[model samples]
Target: MGANFNLKTLTVALAALSAASIASAAGLDRSGQDITAFLQDGVYAEAVYTYLDADVSGYDNAYVGADKNAYQQGNKIDDIAESYDFFRYGVKADINDTFSVGVLYDEPFGAAADYSGDNNFVAQGDRDATINAISGGEVKDFASAANIVGKIQDKVENGGTLTAIEQAQLKKLGPAVAVAQADYNMEGEGTNVEVRTENITAILGAKFGENKEFQVYGGPVAQRVQADVKLRGTAYQAANGYTMNINAGQDYGWLAGIAYSKPEIALKAALTYRSEIDHNLNVSEIFPALAGAIPAAATGMNGEIDITTPKSVNFDFQTGINPTMLATAKVRWVPWSDFEIVPPLYNTGSKADPTNGPDGLSLVSYDKDQWLVELGLAKRLTPALAVTGNIGWDSGAGNPVTSLGPIEGYYSAGLGAKYNLTENWAISAGGKYLWFGDAKGQIPNKFAVSNFEDNDGFALGVKLSYQAKQNFN
Candidate 1:
């Protein structure tokens, strides 16, 4: 029965922590490439449920938030992010002595945030849900405005020659200054953004030749993606009432890998490569200001961004330390630089043409690829109990992170345990903690931000597994 289970507690611990604790790997990465699917034996299935109670403090609207007099020194955005729950299930079967097949259902990538509470981002007194409507055919015009009211204030106070009529305007300068200040602080309450992706993978594997020391596996992966972006606060004043909802879309990719194992001492090593998938997502882009002024198609003009999820490489190894102990390690790399999501027409016609993206500026872009490593130890304490612990590190996707996610890297540690309820059934629990690397989020063409640097996260999970008739001998 023990041999039939073949479950690795370390993998579950890593997955729970990766999904819940690692803020740097938060967006689009829920699983840490755990090989639990392949670890299952004949007619075996397991279900895992995870909950992440994560939040960040000290996040501030990037626009006029820094001006102490306007927003205050301790102007912070708290709990902008709420807790989340995730689940995954999989089954594996042994077809014959040398062949096996498996299937998995999992949420691979997702992101969420809520800023509906009271905050400093909203235009102090102009707390309207929708302000400064930007309609279709005027998207570029609106994006190019670049704080026109503030510019006007500058001219009114610093430059320009005016007559008595203009001099009269000077008397009402207080109101004009207030309006300009409100525009500069557009990042408002109710600003929220969410993205989700799920995957289904079918796998085939075989072990043959020389006492079945070598194993090979490959699979086809299908994924679905959906997202919604809302611009609210004072920092986003120019884009007030702007909402983008991307329709759910499905895409396909492939995975292949090989492994070499020596069961005598429980030594195993494997390497897997996954292909990138392209998605031509259909979306509805709305500019509240131009709701009826422009045709629907013109506002929805966006088939250009073929959202391509990045490819990745995973290598894992484990060796028995003693009759009841094992040492394990893994290395994973993702080319995040090749992945970017920039809504077409959002910032079209760049004032200063960018070298990478022709779409003016990207909604999100990674400056560097990601590299992650893990080291762990697993021990079987008794016939019914087993424990696993691990520590991990991840080189985040970028250095100067974007305001969207301000993590540059992370360090993590986790622990897990499993107890056999019966010979064929087991219950498990795991938890992880992550220390996020400090980062200075920057707004293109604007000043740098430093509020999300000292953030952290935590994750916990539970799982249940069952296996058909098993053979321990």
Candidate 2:
């Protein structure tokens, strides 16, 4: 191979192979936080959009019988995974041959899951099935208690007075009556959770080598996060009516990286590190079912919840396999095990129990860090057209994951194509299919509540990009 090879033309063909990507993985990671746009030869800009849809269903855990002595599998849970989408934009320019600056915007982290159907994950008017499953059939007849309470209410509302005997009965059955009424009031409700986050990063880089083959870059990143959660159904027991609203919060972080390139071989490599961003969000929580035990939970409390998105490292590399073919690889690591979300009031109430002590439970936490690897190949079929294919694997955050997002990890395959409308403009499209790993769903305190298996999903993306060529010599 000669250094005289048309590197600029090759760059255009290979760039599309990396254009429209879907890196849907564990621990709320989306978009893959790609920064390749900054590495292009000259002035480059791109806009990308990605959409993901998943089908996640499972079986709820239940008591073996009225005795509730052992756990058993219960009703079929409906699909909880919701379709999600996000956008990304990046632009970079050489401020001369030695200095370069760029900015990237993306939605980097998020989750969405909603549950419904006749499973324990939903609340119904009768609630008899829910109670039986949750209580091991011991509290057999909720209808009888409901009837007695209803009669007392009817008499009082009709301008009648309660007899002494009736009053005594009311006192004895008051707690049970309250629970039934609460369940009734929440008829047809289901558990749901949604979280969203965004990031904007700015970078300044300097090329140093005699041939300008080496570069170092560093910059600041700003991020915003928000979330909403609702827990319903007997599946949650005392926490059944729990709800949390976290207002949007913005914070800053840093990014640094080093890169190397060889225009002769059309080769490039980069190692990037992103610092964790912390957001102190205003949070409001209501735990209706825990009202009596935790008065603050029932009345709702407002406080601050500190959430730090995990730090990560990414290695991206690509090289020409031949004149018309390019090989690419990506490896990413995220310390998901160190990430957790804990609500102040919830933690305090949990610690009120001697067994829980000071290290109370978190609303969400992962058991392990995540590792993801992807490999791909792209071929320029024509001067204006190129196609690419890739395979990937993700080591999930861990098994027995949060019931809110129960997936372990995924294996995926994808295909993409790019078409150049002109020498400086291109459009790309890609699609990926993911096979999700089976996992047990868990709640706070490491309690397993459901089993999900054989779930799958797909992602689609499109990108429009522009680039102006430059000589690497």
| Candidate with the greatest TM-score versus the true structure | 2
Candidate 2 wrong stretches, greater than 4 Å: 1-5, 64-71, 127-181, 293-296, 352-357, 470-473
What is candidate 2's lDDT per residue for 1-473, written digit by digit as tens?
35444566566566665554665569888878999999887899999988888999989886534232234788899889999889999999998889999999999889999999987777776656544543445455677656776798789889999999777555434344444556668888889999999999999999998888999999999999999998777776545667899999899999999999987777999999999988899999986645545567666889999999999999999887777778899999999999999988767655643545579878898989999898988888888888888999999999888899999999998888888889889998888999999988877755567889999999988889998856545
Give the TM-score (vs. native) of candidate 2.
Answer: 0.88
Q: What is the C-alpha lDDT of each candidate?
A: 0.62, 0.81
Off by over 4 Å in 1: 1-27, 59-74, 116-188, 288-304, 349-358, 444-447, 468-473
Q: Return the number of clashes found in candidate 1.
A: 18
